[model samples]
Target chain A: MQDPLGRLAAQIGSGMKLAVPVDYGGVPMALTRAIIAAGIDDLHLVCVPTGGMQVDMMIGAGLVKTIETSAVSLGEAGGAPQFNAAVRAGRVAMMDATCPAIHAGLLAAQKGVPFVPIRGLIETDVLANRLDWCVINNPMADDTGDDPIVLIPAIHPDAAIFHAPMADRFGNVWIGRRRELAAMAYSTKTTLVTVERMFDGDLMADEMTAAGTLPALYVTDVAVAARGAWPLGLWGEYDGDVAEQHRYAQAARTPEGFAAYMASDVRAGAA
Target chain B: MSTPTTAHEILIVSIARLLRGTRHVAVGAASPIPAAGAMLARALAETQDEPKLRLSILGSVAHNFFTNGSAELFDCAAQGRIDAFFLGGGQIDGSGNVNLVGVGDYPEGTVRWPGSFGSAFLYFQIPRVILFREEHTPRVMVEKVDFISAPGVSSEGIWRKGGPHALLTGKGLFGFDATRPGFHLQTLHPGHTLEDVTAATGFRFSHAHATPETPPPDAATLALIRGRIRDELHESYPDFAATLRTAPLPSPLKEPSS
Candidate 1:
């Protein structure tokens, strides 16, 4: 159950229900396909605000449920600049998810530290809703005495699925970059990893990727899914398919719209 | 007729070097230059000629990589890490404020279009944000944008994700000053001057007195770029290839190819 990828596939209770980022390649792609194969509705997808691993084929598989993203992306493909009329017509369900990964908000929750100092939460209900937010006494002991700090409870996903460059057969994973990935890695209760190629020893032998393996140990299952990060983009070396993206955008703007689009494909149409 | 050199190819090469051999670099929607460059870099690196640089890519299905057609590197996308990226701005104010989304009222615009699609987060969290443009105009570079698409100096309470590093254009290059958070002119390009630059911008600038000019793309590099666009890229995308209706006569490229 702790194997991130495996648990992720199982968490949504099969029957086609899933939510994941909208990315170009890598982990996001793995999540989409795995979700579909696991029997989650492909239409229930969460779109990452930034560039990340995402798959449109899942929608064609009737595996997506809803898109939780920014209000800006709602019409990204349908309007001018570059228009995909079919997507605008509502083939998939799009939701103004309001960027689930608000760095400050999410970071606050992940640390379990009360009142994690964060900006941009001023004067809004968003800051008020978190009952756990508590303030810290300042050194000055000023009468403005309401504390300044806040508490961010850890946000462990039902599971975290990822595609890594390398992983040991035992399921020890290796991620090349450790930006905010640690936040997502530790925050999740379960993790699934797919490596580019299998290896026997610990990926930690290399100094750079050594620390990368620690988080993998926190994961549940490690699988060898070569080139698992498809559709979503990789940063330095590879590029993605532009035409397929257009086709996806044309298909994934609404529920009914995407359903018809899914019907067009055989394998993708039936989950 | 014959094919001449192209700025697009030159721009793509410049970007590949910036990536420093990373397998994937993040890109946003509607940015054709970086998208194309990112794809081309992966293609060249994967080929036997540059086997040392083993790389490929997978763009988003929602049209992130504006390549001419389907991409060959679909497998790499499963890894999903777009830490660095490039963005565009229709209005970049002196304060380094960007506005690409839309302007004016809700829905119906009294003024500009939706300011930025993703510049806000891209500028802060992506680690590397290389803002680029070809047409340097006052409209593009303003004193202050009507809207601040992304916050350069995010409030201390908030951990500002990504911020831009460089501003590239045909006229010159600008890098961000961590202290100032705005642009410090780095280098001017060939056949350009302060007058030409200032004339194009709509904002106030602190120009450097000794700004140097960027050297033009060299002959050898140009030839290599030409070959890729004409022969390699053309073969990949016949439609794009057709755009190159003719070629210019050859000159001193690669010292006559030995």
Candidate 2:
């Protein structure tokens, strides 16, 4: 039998646009490592709003071709060294964006709209850099003076990958309050999820879980990968391994240090 | 009282003062001082029997009330529900433009800070935006930001409802004037002089003949910050809260020398 986790990783091929969530939201670190081990390259990574260690690792491994993100940092641990180096070296195509614009783009995709209008980014370099984003007068305005607004083009990624705390046998994943995951899943062609455990009962049947559950219709695949978001944290399950994160931040400063850190006992031990 | 105020405490007090009279204040992730200040303001308001202040600290389960994840924060801001917010940058200029992207050039720069988060939007939506950068230096406060992550002021025809209200740094506080579209030195922090501020700042800003010093937190305010505020902050910022525990207590004033 094929390893389900490997199968899920295989679903994410090279040179595909993949959307991932923020750090506090389930990060799918295990799946990220699996993809790295598979040596996938030229992936266009999209941070729903921002990225963290997961993004840095992928960039350090020379896997990302482009990054569409608001920001990519290790939270309090500090700047994402690998990401910084890559951008500074012009290794990756950086599509700089603000948080709302990214969300607006995703929302447009989710709604199957061509674009979504947002409030800000006018007269700023953030708007200037985004050639695809346009500004137009509000057509709905009642003949009032021009009401300029930003229109963010829809962002429909090839795949959405993330980790979740639980999933039922029916493939319904309980994302709890991390509704951004739902937006990603709704907007992507395929959504691959790695959950900590399987629920015996139908998630949709339970009143409490139903509200938080992402219907299996939107989820393309689900695999049980315990501690899938390890080193990162699952909202209710455990706290992030800050020490390990700090170590990665420190070690990944230099290219050689990053390569060595990737091969060290820490990476192996995470298995 | 002879309790020497730490820089962090001073900043917290200042932030709280800026946040006063606001109905709702939102803070972003990794902001300890701003988060503490919001908490302090909320606590102070409760004590004074004022209208309840709603605080939404992103990334905190206890503090954040949004059920729709990250989008809701922006959504709330767009509707002008968030009254006040805090924004920091790699560089801030005299015109109130902020650069969170990086330095040098566009796309690929010599140095790269994190990309712009929600500042471009939040800075436009929130009525009172307090720019906070703990580092006070010429490099950080530039004459012109290499990139404008979010502009401080927009043109006359631009549809903007909000912009920079004030700028607080480690050295002092600067108030942004929308009409002149410039920052003016408002008050210097304790132990810092005008000459020191001038040397540290890269951008030119106006100041009165003698800029007043930022008032330190009173005994009552310090007690609240060290006590209830610290305890409340622990839920989101554990390490920062721990440091607050060891902060100096107010010592009784000595009798006048005979």
RMSD of each: 10.6, 4.0
Per-model CA lDDT versus the true structure: 0.48, 0.91
* DockQ, candidate 1, vs. native dimer: 0.06
lDDT of 1 at A166: 67
For model 1, the stretches where C-alpha displacement exceeds 4 angstroms are A1-8, A13-25, A28-31, A34-110, A114-156, A178-180, A195-198, A201-210, A214-217, A223-226, A233-243, A246-271, B1-87, B90-96, B102-147, B151-258
Name the 10 consecutive residues with the lowest summed lDDT in model 2 chain B. B246-255
lDDT agreement of model 2 with the native: 0.91
**Displacement of the residue B135 alpha carbon in candidate 2, Å:** 0.8
Question: Among these predicted structures, which one has the highest lDDT?
Answer: 2
Error of 1 at B130 (Å): 7.9
Q: Candidate 2 residues A1-271, lDDT tens each?
A: 7678778889989999999999999999888888888888999999989999999999999889999999999998999999999999999999999998999999999899999998878889999988989999999987777889899999999999999999988889999988999999999979999999999999999789999999999999998888888788889988899998998999999988898988873357345
- State the local distance difference test value for candidate 1: 0.48
Let me know the DockQ for model 2: 0.75
Q: Each candidate's fnat, in order? A: 0.02, 0.85
